[model samples]
Target: MEEHNIFSLIADNLSQFYEYTGFANATFGHILMILIGLAFVYLAIKKEWEPMLLVPIGFGIIIGNIPLFPGLSVGVYEEGSVLNILYQGVQQGYYPPLIFLGIGAMTDFSALISNPKLMLIGAAAQFGIFGAYGIALALGFTPAEAGAIGIIGGADGPTAIFLSSRLAPDLVGAIAVSAYSYMALVPVIQPPIMRLLTTKKERLIKMKSPRAVSKKEKIMFPIIGFLLTAFIVPSGLPLLGMLFFGNLLKESGVTRRLAETARGPLIDTVTILIGLTVGCSTQADKFLQWTSIKIFILGFLSFVIATAAGVLFVKFFNLFLKKGNKINPLIGNAGVSAVPDSARISNNIGLEYDKTNYLLMHAMGPNVAGVIGSAVAAGILLGFLS
Candidate 1:
């Protein structure tokens, strides 16, 4: 009787240890995931690859890979766990919308409105999105998965997240990381392609000064544009509405305090949350797949194709216009959704050609339009997949 009692006690303790540690059952794949998460952190801190996002994502990846890491027993939340709470917001699709609001507050639409024709450059750049989607489909991804992957070409983080949430939630973290990573690397990615596509004469081509914009036009622009966009692509309302609303606040004289807050404190706070939440989604199990590698490769290719497409389209547009009205092909590269960074690069390259040339304002036309184009592309993907 005594021996039997001791044996039963040992068995109970062994079972409890296995339940608590999870190492009693962890596999090789699980260990590989932890290493990948650490690699992301190393790259973020050491290589500085979008450190804002990579740091948090790396931490999240680590936390997520721990076996039985408290409430992850069945591969999901069971309440009272840190990941459970964070995971809820992502699953509910909350972060992307809030992030959109912050993005709107940060954007300046003056350039886009002053030069509506540049909107076409933004539209032309989206060829990469469709082109990538076709390639992804060819690679054997389902339509929904390919759509999520293709938005990487847009180079817009929030739009990618929004599309991924609806189309391919499983690939969201990888897609978002890839999108932002390429956007940050725009300077490196774009110039080589631009140089290859345009000759010195094209690069040196002088562009006319953009027409002056009026305050009244600025105030009315967001409203009219929002209405047009909402009517035409209701699916884009979440992104476009927030963006235009932010712009309205900036342009409206009465909303100085609100605009200041949106551009400053509000965006800062949300960026922290957005960064951390995005990072947390990079758990090894989800991130280290063969598909994840393919997504990154596809995203990089999409960006290259988009850049090439934009430059070629602008050159094509130049053929139809009078000489003085011709646009600098460098500005065409800004049509991809890298925002101010790509636009700044365009301005820099223009200065390289002619010290007096200022392509910043001109480049912004396509830069802002790229935002709308990305949202539209995302909407199209959602339409097809959802």
Candidate 2:
């Protein structure tokens, strides 16, 4: 009886050990995703590519992929899990509006107001969204999925997340990651396209300074922009509304405290939560599909197309302009919704040809316009697809 009891105890201990070992149930997919997560962390730290977002997202990816025993209620997807609670901000599309509020607070509309015609460049770049939409449709995605995927071309992560959550929840993780990753790579990806399309002369072409924008015009912009955009694309109200509100707070000249909070702490906190939740959403089993791969490919192509469209639009504009008044096509690349990074890239590349030509302020005109254009494009897609 003693020997039998010893054997029973040994067997029970082994069984418990086996039960606790995550490696026992871990699949190849989990390992692959974990490695990919580590790669994101490496890029964040070593390359310093959007570190604030990439680091949290990378770590969250690792957290999401850790194998858990069956029926555990603590996983990100588990109904009652803490991660699941955090993830609700993503699933219900809460984070994007808050993020837009922050963006609006921080953004300066002076550049855009100074050169209102450059707004056309931003609108023209949105061609990428429709282009990707058609491609996704050809590739067999549903209208809703295609619409969500198309937003990736806008190079706007928050907008992508918001659209995906509304139209294709299954793809939120993939779309969000693709949009952000591409946005971060704008400095690398956009220059080649900008260079490829423009001649040396076009890049060197210098424009006159933008006209001064009156303070009254500045104050009226948010109100009018919001009203016009909201009435045209009511579906975008959540994002546009918050964006205008935040801008109003900043430009109103009386809400400095609110603007400061929105642009600083509020945005930072929301960015962290958004990044982590989005990363955690990419669980191995869910994310390791052909659809996610397709989304990435389509997203890359969309960005390229958008950049090209902006450049071509500028080149076309030059056909009728006097030499002295000709706009630098290089600034056109900033039409992609990557914001200051795209504008900065345009400035850097322009300097390679002519250091005297300052394109930053000019680029910013289309850069900020791209933000509005992308939001409007998203609203249009949501209207048609949803």
What Cα-based lDDT does every candidate model obtain? 0.81, 0.91
Best by TM-score: 2
Tens-digit lDDT track for model 1 on 1-386? 99999999999999887877858656676677678668878987887766766677666666666666444533434464555566665656666666666667677777777668899999999988988999999999999999999999998887888888888888887897788778768878998898889888988887777777888998888799889887888888888888888888888878888888877887666666655666666665667789989999999989998998899999999999898889889999888887888888888888887898888988989988998889878877787788
RMSD of each: 3.2, 1.5
Model 1 TM-score, all chains together: 0.88
Show model 2 residue runs off by greater than 4 Å: 1-7, 10-14
lDDT of 2 by residue, 1-386 (tens): 99999999999999988886778778899899889889999999999998888898888898888888856777789998899999999999999999999999999899889878899999999998989999999999999999999999998889999999999999999999899889888988899999999889788888889888887888899999999999999999988998889999999999999999999999999999999999999999999999999999999999999999999999998888787778899988888888789999989998999989889999999999999999999898888888
What lDDT does model 1 reach?
A: 0.81
Off by over 4 Å in 1: 1-49, 66-80
Backbone atom clashes (below 3 Å) for every candidate: 1, 0
Report how far off residue 155 is in candidate 1 (Å): 0.4
